[model samples]
Target chain A: MNVRKQFRAGSEFRIADHHPGDKPLSSGDKPADQLRVSGLAEQIAAFQDIFYAEHRRKLLVVLQGMDTSGKDGTVRGVFGRLDPLGVRSVAFKAPSTDEREHDFLWRVHEQVPAMGQLVIFNRSHYEDVLVPVVHGDINEPECERRYRHIREFERMLCETGTVLVKFFLHISRDEQKRRLEARLQEGDKHWKVDLNDLKERRYWDAYQERYERAIRETDTDPAPWYVIPADSKTHRNLAIASVMIDVLQDMKLSYPPPNPEYFKIKVE
Target chain B: MNVRKQFRAGSEFRIADHHPGDKPLSSGDKPADQLRVSGLAEQIAAFQDIFYAEHRRKLLVVLQGMDTSGKDGTVRGVFGRLDPLGVRSVAFKAPSTDEREHDFLWRVHEQVPAMGQLVIFNRSHYEDVLVPVVHGDINEPECERRYRHIREFERMLCETGTVLVKFFLHISRDEQKRRLEARLQEGDKHWKVDLNDLKERRYWDAYQERYERAIRETDTDPAPWYVIPADSKTHRNLAIASVMIDVLQDMKLSYPPPNPEYFKIKVE
Candidate 1:
């Protein structure tokens, strides 16, 4: 199956349309699927080396999901093998005092990848649209305005040679409850367990509706969103890796040609 | 020898006191020195992985030098082996309109490395002081004020879990002339040969004097500056890699302990 086409968010995309438990990218054997993820991750790392050497194009991967939806795990599994020098994972928390002084996109714009870079945003400007809309901090018209701003901002990044990939890790409500319970039960994970996550869980349906609207309104050819079925961690990783590999392969990345003149001249 | 102590800028530090051609770190064998640099680079990469996992400390490597002093080359040689995910090289060119609207350090402060990140500044806030002083755009008092600001800014970073290592790649005027000439002669290098560099070369002595004053005024215990002899590319690489390895070793970086509870829990 063409995983990219299968997961690509369209205008008609509904958060409920896709089953979170589906394992479209997985083979029948679980261990084999896990092995496939590892192999693809290594290949992505190799491609990243050339991508850094080429030093021409930029790639930005935006990951947005509900809490306990495996954003961090996806980073560790899919992108962890890549060299830290060229790839950066920026996790956005709530805006600080200084961040609130500027427009919402101010901090986000400052962290975009430069030439020969691939940066993954653990959460992104999408949060600005979702949280506010769900809380009624911004009305529907204001939320729509912010979506327009995001589309324009992304289009600008694309025009300036950035390849954008947005992923929404889709997890079922029951899966979230299980993950949250695991956080509570595990002593080591107690540190990561926030009462706020449970509080946020109360706004589940509102968040889902906001996410669907945000993804639908801003989904463009230049920066398409991918909704990954994330209940199965292994399948989520495999599917995201597959989509990234396809995107990078289509980029036709190659290192800048060796300088012929530079070869002849010896460093004195 | 304490490599860090040997290169640390002092109150009496003068740019002319250090010879750009001196290879204090070299062992007299040229090829062997190059090999040593490669080895050090690998060791530093390994330390970086642990440092990243530790996620406690921050490292800031600031590169400052005149034109053709090998700032870019130093990044490629000493920092190239690092994983791109943990390391970032931010090249600060002339300020844009938006940047000019803010205080000089505004754009800079926004780019400081987060926890577990190592950031290299190609040309940093130092530029704010240097170019203005050299061109008489800012008077001596203004320059001194900017130096005070830098000292405080760096101190703030140091206090906040950041280990600062600033390098001034010291290359002689004659060596710079040779490099510029080679850039002009080589077809492959023509793209990198900026005409502005030639124009800036006219203010060579002024720039050197300003750099000396900047280094002397800002050098402190927490954030020390290293004067690197950069005439010999291989020696320059070796000296820098050695300094960096020494600094990172001093940091005593280690991964966060494995979570015992996490170890026991199997993913369902």
Candidate 2:
């Protein structure tokens, strides 16, 4: 289904479909999704090995979302089964004084994964558009130029063998509020919730406006964005996991043939 | 056992002792010390969970080694078991044009792990000391200044709650030659071994001398270095896994309990 087509129909952009998988909301007992999860996990792992062995292609995954939209949780739940060696995740936060002194993409460009590796941008280059657009850090003319540069940058990545997959975890304001409060009430979790988060909450409407526009403008062929419904964390995990599997399977990777002369190594 | 104290005694630097109660080089299907491996694996997994849950103490794992020293294999074997969401790996290459324009540490500092996460520097801050010190990128007086700055920077990291674990994957030159040849003979493995690797191989002796001095000088009380033998990949994984478990377990942590009482307001 064309998820983005549906998203453009109205001003209020949100996730419409929830996953039909049987992953239960409560953590008590999960009835064997391991077979499904493990199958996909093994496939992803195998694909990663081929990418490394062949040293041919690159892949990038960009995950952008509001707080409690399951960026971290979805990553944990989906890629949990793969080997960490070939996979790299870069989480971008507020720019440091030194970073702010340079171009926005300077810090990000440094973290892009090497050839034959998968790079995940957690709240990635999109921030150049979203955060600055909402906070009015740059004028409209400058914002337009920055957005153009981002598109070209990603296009260059795609040309250089990067198969980019971008996901935007869509959550409602109400769901976010409930999750934020939960973080505050939990024993050790209070540390995760900052009072500054409340300030960001106030800018929700402005951020949403900026997000939708950026999605509309930058959702090109090589780097399309998928908006996943993340209200129910379980459903969100299963859906994203399925999407990730579909991408790797499409890549048509296989484990390199086991060397027939492997026994030649005399273990001393 | 006081591993650091043992490290101080030059004679105790034997690679075999890392296996402790087992024949480390054995090729049996069953690990030489099954009980120890299982116990250590479980402890490592649990401690990583607490470290992940804490959402406060950031971790920096610096992996430095000689050519064919099992750096890639160790990351794959040990961290392969970690929850991928909570970890990020950054591999440092020879500095680019823009990177060289700045101080050596400038590029590395940008990649430091954020709060509530684990960041592995496949080669780290010590590169400023080791590479330049060996390659003549700087003079003795300037190199000494960098050595002090690195110590101070690491001390700062610890003060700011970033737990640092530095591992030196130690392997004999003969073993390295064997592994490199293995890569060449294997069907798809040849891509990882480039001509530059052979060029770099010529400097092994100089690299080792520099490493010996750096380890002795910078191995501090707060961030002591662990020199794991890479002759056997299994032993390297097992030893590093055990040390990581010890560190994370020392930092007590708990899950962020959900607020069952919060009512979810439906936005219609």
Candidate 1 residue lDDT tens string, B157-229: 6754688999999998999999999999999999989999999999999999988999999999898899999
Question: What is every candidate's C-alpha DockQ against the true complex, given to 2 decimals?
Answer: 0.03, 0.01
Where is model 1 more than 4 Å wrong at Cα?
B1-268
Indicate the TM-score of model 1: 0.53
Candidate 2: list runs displaced more than 4 Å.
A1-268, B2-42, B256-268
**Could you give candidate 2's per-residue lDDT for residues A142-215 as a string of tens digits?**
77767666676566556546788888777888888998989988978887787887789999988877877777
Candidate 2, pairs of clashing residues? none
* Chain A TM-scores in order: 0.98, 0.83
lDDT by residue for model 1 (A27-51), tens: 9899999999999999999999999
What's the residue-level lDDT of B19 in candidate 1? 92
- TM values, all candidates: 0.53, 0.47
